[model samples]
Target chain A: MVKCGLEIHQQLATKKLFCECNSELSEEILYKFERVLRPTQSELGEIDRAALEESLKKRRFIYEVTPNSCLVEADEEPPHELNREALEIALKIALMLHAKIVDEIHVMRKIVIDGSNTSGFQRTALIAVDGYIDTFFGRVRIPTICLEEEAARKIEEKDGGVVYRLDRLGIPLVEISTSPDMKNGEQVKEVAERI
Target chain B: MDTLRSKHIYKVKILSPNMEVEPGDLVEVKTKKGTFRGILMPKHEFSDENIIVLKLDNGYNIGLIPEEIKCIKKGIRRKKKSLYKFEKKDLPQISIISTGGTIASYIDYKTGAVHPALTAEDLIFSAPEIEEEANIKAFVLFNILSEDMNPLYWIQLARKIKDELKESHGVVIPHGTDTMSYTSAALSFMFSKLSGPVILVGAQRSSDRPSSDAYMNLISAVRVAKSDLGEVAVVMHATTSDDHCFIHRGTRVRKMHTSRRDAFKSVNSQPLGEVRGNKVIFYEGYRKVEEDVELYDKLDEKVSLIYYYPGMSGELMTRMLEGMDGAIIMGTGLGHISNEMIPLLKDFIRDGGVVGMSSQCIHGRVNLNVYSTGRKLKKIGVIPLEDMLPEVAYVKLMWLLGNFERDEVIKLLPQNLRGEISARRMIIW
Candidate 1:
């Protein structure tokens, strides 16, 4: 038997998930800074596999920022409260899919050090889980739904460093995951469209 | 014991007196937003009050407000120890001189701070692959940021290199990228002829980071040191990949980027050679080793470099000319300064001040005969430095002033000294 799973990421039309910055891309750059990220040991006293892999490449990260970028986007300031508008839209989608919302929202860090995000790790929170959507062929179970921040858009790579625009960073994004229930490619498409 | 030196001492006083905490200790903190668990980090020397710093388990650092803290609990402490062991083998001897940069450093797990690796053992511990290629002998001349490096240090460094060449095949200098090119140019002039290669290497990132270019750069430097190349050069990453490193002439290279593994580029000329795998490939017209080495360690540092820009006043130019032995003007286009400063420059030249002009374009030769502004400036006695970089011209002027008379300096500023000026420009990408 063949098992398939789908993970979909969609951007939210609202303010950034972790800051008060506007969710828009800016063409003018105001400032730039460089940083070197290092991998840290986890709670289990072992480093995450992906974080360890990224730490090995040892490339310097350059961030091109605009006025829209707050101290949060530059990693100089701590993140603010989560965006309520983004959370409301995420809840609306969860209700539409008949997914059960969690009692408490906890932000977790997923390590990603490819210079895409100013912060070495991306912040994500599980909003809902365990829901079912009906398709023409069968029912596809939604295993998880998460709200996260979008990474910075890479502008160019040169001189042994990667440059990223801070305008796209911190924008809210919704991630929806589904368990394998489709028997054919047509059914998978139907399931994706239904969501 | 590492003490927490933050201004949030009032908050620490509020916490239970029974619990003792220090920087780098594992601790759990409870705040109004949530509970945070990680290693307690020392406060930044200039950080504001009412906030605590923590290095989270996921390797991300976060700042917590003191007002939201409910309680703090200390956790188990773990001490990390190095496990590197060196085995001596029969190989070419290479001397490494650590001059303080990311290339000679590793992150301290306890404080999350980077410290210079002083001894050969420390470098070998970080990059064990060096032991397989060469018999390493390391020394720490002085630990300072490259920006703080001066002509005195260059003289001392040249003398040290002369002494090290007696026992080693080559010498490697791990330097900070900010002023690596200036140091390279200074050394090229100081050492008239060398018995072996004197390679200067630097890293874009610290060695503790897995993606650091330190290992490959040091490897390439050692390899070049062991090769037949006999001139001073800067060995760094040629591309973003780990394939090879380009060996740029000491006086012809510049750090073109603020932060990048390949920040150093050969300006106005091609690289002297390239280090691929374990071998060095010399380009055409490369310098060869000679049996006898000559060293010139005198440099007059009373020279100034003025980078010309629009709307700049002549007062700044006048001040730079005051008590200056010589000056290098980085002019616009084909080496032309604004018309306003031309009269003051003429007076300065008449007062026995030696001045040379180089283009800020960083490429192409300076032709003072091209435009009217160039010709007018040339009449004022500003020597056009042909195809020489501004920093290199500055160093060359210092060397010339130290060793030659005022008239001789004017004559020597335009001549090619230690390959600072190319005979013919080559178009190579």
Candidate 2:
């Protein structure tokens, strides 16, 4: 017997979540840059636990840029306004899930320092919460649904450092996390397939 | 009307017989219209004797002359929680001057609005840790909102700060965030030399709020006040978190966002410093304490600021520059008005109405050498102010017109004073 949970990551059909970069991935590298990441303080005035753990390794990261990459991808500029198309798509999914939509969407940064993010943080926002889907086995609860920017795609490793391409860093990604209430792997598979 | 109960500003005749009522008591009242229940409110001195104020359920206050009342019972007593505390110790003497903003304001229950509520001592004692940072001397100059702040008020405040700095090591002004950068720029130009730091601070949220930025800002300001810097700076949150506060130079900072905690940002330059826990970290570019203040508090009120918009009529342009000693034009990119407005501006300049050109684009310097229209404006005697914020340039023009002659105002408008203009071009923010 196994207790199972499902976390579905779905890519949206829109422009990059922040900047106006296109969603197409290219292999031809235009430029490359190297960066060292440091953790930032959260709203609670404390460094995030996972971010601290990543900081302990103290490694460098190199990013290969594509034609679509701009100053925002290199972390030389601030991110642009959120893509409205991506937001609407996520909102529609949350509505279909019968979830309770939040009154205000507050974008928060989740620290990720393993060379995936240039700013050492992942931008995410809670779109909805507390909805459940009925299955033949039981009711699998959907604890949260979030909209986030996808991490940079990992490439080859060089000199004990991880390299990532900038093409995938700002793409819109939706996360649907379900509770570990499914008693069997088959029930989990059913919930995943149906959702 | 019991004289012993001084809280009762109304007549005893208004009350029911054998009934005692106090402010903060829960009471159910009835009149010819209907029944009402709310917490009893203290009578204001200006209120009529027959009227009684009550705070209703929807966070509104209503005044009524009741016909009958019942249940003078106690309401839910709330104990105010102290957010921060510290033991008083020997510290640098700092003067905190309150000019009425969210920092020292409290909710006026009578009107359901925030009012300037704290005295000097009340301000310091609100967050006791501020006392631990500095031996504070608080003075509330006035309680007006920042929008009402004028050039004359800046003059008066400068005079007060000079007087305070003689006795205190430094001064911190709690002001309204709106138009705060203008005041800082005004004060920066008014004082050439200073004995100590003159720091201005404001909060986006009120002090009564648990998430109020006031507590951290006040403490950080007090700490920065005790530092060795002599220039006027605006201190606000470095980030949205409760981590630390950045010290922005008065001439370079602007309120970039409407209501964010880190709204005050240094426009073209980096901040002078930041204050973290138990530490005031100074950055590269900051001035040190000087001997004493050489106060030049004069300001010509006739100088006007005009922004050039597309399709602006010549009549409007002429009217904006008419009857003014000088004008600061917030021009388009590279500091250019339409080709038509240039001739009118030339006439204005020919008539001794000094005009200075500043960019509407908030960041980057104005370059008259790059564009043709810019060169035309320059040839017509429009002084191009470099890299200076339009608002700062406007304030500086007023200050220059007041202190100097006509020729000097023109000559000095392009020159850098009070770190208003950056010398070198920068690629990064």
Candidate 3:
């Protein structure tokens, strides 16, 4: 009774998710700043119990900014329009898998309190849902495919504090999640490749 | 003699002329299209003059050119939802002044129309947390979008806030965000001093939406109204997320974004402070509550704000500044227009027009000494408003012309009044 699912994250070779910042990193640090991140409630005005618990820790995060990031990653500027290339890539993948593209793509904010996102949340959008990939062993149902921005790269932790690099904070990433239909690890790997 | 019949603004000729149906009246109408029974909705300004609107029981609105109308009832009584009931307590006595915007609006279940909530009870009902924090008193100044805001209304509003401050601990103004900063800046220049804080609050989203910052901003503004600050300031979301609210000085703040929750930012200066939970924090470089209020509620409405563009013709510039007593030009970097336009501006200044220079950059100070064109502008009597926003400069010039003589206004245009002109500039984006 071994049930398995596959979730694969692939970064799109495109501009940053919400701004015109480059996806490529720089060797020299442009600026460094300190910020304190807290968890936010959902649109329904209900705080997730887990996020509320994490917010109680009250962690201070230091962000090492580079040329790859701008005011957007610094959480100083509002987000621009979504990246078209990254969106097209996700749509193309979903269409190839025969997934039903959502009538309205809702770019949702996922609350993240780990100080990895400068805005204290990760932006994601559901591209498609309810598609399937047939493996040699069984039929693996592709539950959802989402387009999301990558979290900041964790540089190090010092004095019980976390330091993150803003360079990778906004790079667009495609996540394809499968249902728990795979029977074994080999079939899960096969299904992931097919997607 | 009917109490409700003559009170309605709907004078549609198509409806039975003898039968006058007022808004909130439950009427059954028979038309060429079909028979409809619903509550007569209030006449919106934008609706056709000949047609009547109705809100059906299904909560949808419909407009029709009716043939005949029969009143089923004189008026429909509204069943009020559970609202925050005010109980007498020893909290800070704060006044909530509604100026009619999305912040102070609610859907009438009877007619399905959104009416501007104009009382302290409406405010507390929306954000119930304020009931325990403050003993609220409320009134409405007017119901107009801030885009339609004018110098005349600013004067009246200044007088009103001044009067309210005499009794309440502070005053909270719920205004439209389109020109909230403009009104804030005008009030900042008008009220030289205040006995308590005057906080202007607005919502990016209407109150009907779940994620609207209306109640949160109102609650935070009530907290700020009870604080130790005495400046006329704006309290809005400090971030896009619903974390806290920033208390931005009326003279220093600007609406940076169109519709984001964190649109209003303290440009060229740090925010005065912020409101976090129940704890109101005050930062450095802010005015505290004074002993007495200094009132200067006069403003010259004959001022124009012109945005100077590349290759802008002198004819257009002259036309723009033709009847203006004063003009604030949103100029290029370092506050410069074309050399050709400079002579026209000089002529305008010579012919009794006070032209002030404020950069369109919006973040930095206007330094008229760096470039030759700027020096020419300075020589031609263009007042350089260092770090003052173009809109603020426009309103400030208007206030100066209204209160002072020509000689005194020219002397005081560049001087620091109500922190409009910061002595030093900061590198802010």
Candidate 4:
């Protein structure tokens, strides 16, 4: 197995990950939203393992948005057109990685179990795919480019809204997983740095 | 995997009825190595020895040695009854645009975590300290922490605060400590002429924790809100011991530690007053709440903070300033920088982009007159924020930009507002 993966996270310079909301943490209660899981019927009609597990738990997520960090979290309102600045930054990073940028971008959902993401799933989209970077020893082939919503930072484990550190939430991050082509830890580190 | 199968099964003997382990009751189990507290799941049936199993907070099961066990205390389980009675007081209408932090928080059961318990009643109940001061009308504008706080929230909060200031006695904001100073500073500038006090309060510990400062901070903030001080100020623990609380000017405070009761400090300036018990004793001079206060509800969010380090490139500064309206440089000792970057700094200033310097050391004032680098920065028109924290400088810059022109902001950068900049250095070096 040529197991190679890329792991990455980039800060979305925009005020928040995807909205005009200021992502921050505080002791003040801003707006409180309660959410319950409503499973989306997939095309295959088979729910993914993670989503099924979460659905079974019957978890209720109470998402909190401060005055500075507002209702964009509820999905009650569509994000103020994906933060163009963050998108541009992601594109720039993808280009630097020698990846091919996709002509169009479509936001997709990726399930998260740890409750870091208030929406139960993260909003992610592929900006580019199939790229490579130069290394001292050889060329490292990069596969897949993804732009995703950063998860809510966990603040404290309590009853209603799990106190998530808002500072890290909605900060656009870039994650790149690679195939396991490297035989040793040094190669993994090298490829990680190159990406 | 093997560790799970061969997990140490200590024999636990419940010697006293006081130590009875019920199936679902929470218990504090003591061991030779350490103490573990969790809900008692059940007794292991397969084991020949009488061992008790506990579901640890982290979701792991531990079996205790019955013979080697010393003691077990069933925890004081208090059934949570709603502590609030719905009493709508006909008090002056005030808008509480809650930008979410820990203010409306409680311990969650299913996930065994802590989260924001954000009903209006929950918020009020979490901090009963507010009842002594004013009747509150709240609006949860957003659910976010201070670190994630951005310009939009600040602007929205300012608008909400401005609208309420006309009718309310005061506005109290519960915010996160990490970036409370930044938000406070932003509000201070946005509501430059705010007549009623806009007090931003936050707790170092979660409300669920025994030592949490949420209650005290809220109480003090309410007092500050109702006080004669009409400015944006942060109310937080004055010291680690929590004996007193201090009222910090919005543009002068910063979170000094990640976790501490007294996390916020007035960088380079003294706090406006100290709140002991229920009294706000003003110890320093402050801007008097002016009548018909003009609210500046605008922000230039493009501004960024450029922290300088040894051998930092001019390219980084240039990139950040390329299209930025303002920049705050957290510079080295006495506000010095690599002289190589002086030309870029000068150009940045000339480009109509405001550049201000704050000491990274955070304790003392920034004086550009002592060294050549300082002189270079001064020549470049890099206004040194004598003793203001970096976050405060950023907020002040954003606020000045909202109402004043670039040139005017450059001139006003060093001027004191709400004690953000100190006129005289305390001479610590």
Best by lDDT: 3
Q: Which of candidates 3 and 4 is the stronger one according to DockQ?
A: 3
Question: For model 3, how does the per-residue alpha-carbon lDDT over B1-429 read when each residue is reduced to its tens digit?
Answer: 011112236767645445667777888877664577888877655456666776656333556677898888877554342222344767888888877677776534344345566454445445554667888776667777667778788888888898888888899999988899999999888888889999999987655433457867988999999988989999999985566899999998898887677899998888889988778898897888998899888889899899988878989988998888999999998898999898888888999999899999887889899999999899989999888899998898989999999999998988988888878765555
Docking class of 2: incorrect
**Order by DockQ, highest first:** 1, 3, 2, 4
Lowest summed-lDDT stretch of 10 residues in model 1 chain A? A38-47
Look at candidate 2 and give me any clashing residue pairs: B1-B12
DockQ for candidate 1: 0.08
Candidate 3 residue lDDT tens string, A46-143: 33556544654565677888978887887755688999989999999998777877544656556576789876667887777677887799778886
Residue B28, model 2: lDDT of: 80
Report interface Cα RMSD per prediction: 9.3, 15.1, 11.4, 22.1
lDDT of 4 by residue, B127-229 (tens): 5435546676655566676668888888788887877788777888877667788888888776658678888988765554333567678878877887778
lDDT of 2 by residue, A1-195 (tens): 678888999988798999989987889898776654533222222334565446534656778999877766665455787899999999988888888765445454565767787766677877776778888898888978889999888998877468899998889999999988899877877888887
Error of 2 at B154 (Å): 0.2
lDDT of 2 at B37: 79
Among all windows of 10 consecutive residues in model 4 chain B, the one with the lowest summed lDDT is B1-10
Better of 3 and 4 by TM-score: 3
- List the RMSD of every prediction in angstroms: 9.5, 12.2, 10.7, 22.9
Ordered by TM-score, highest first, the candidates read: 1, 3, 2, 4
Interface RMSD after interface superposition, model 3:
11.4
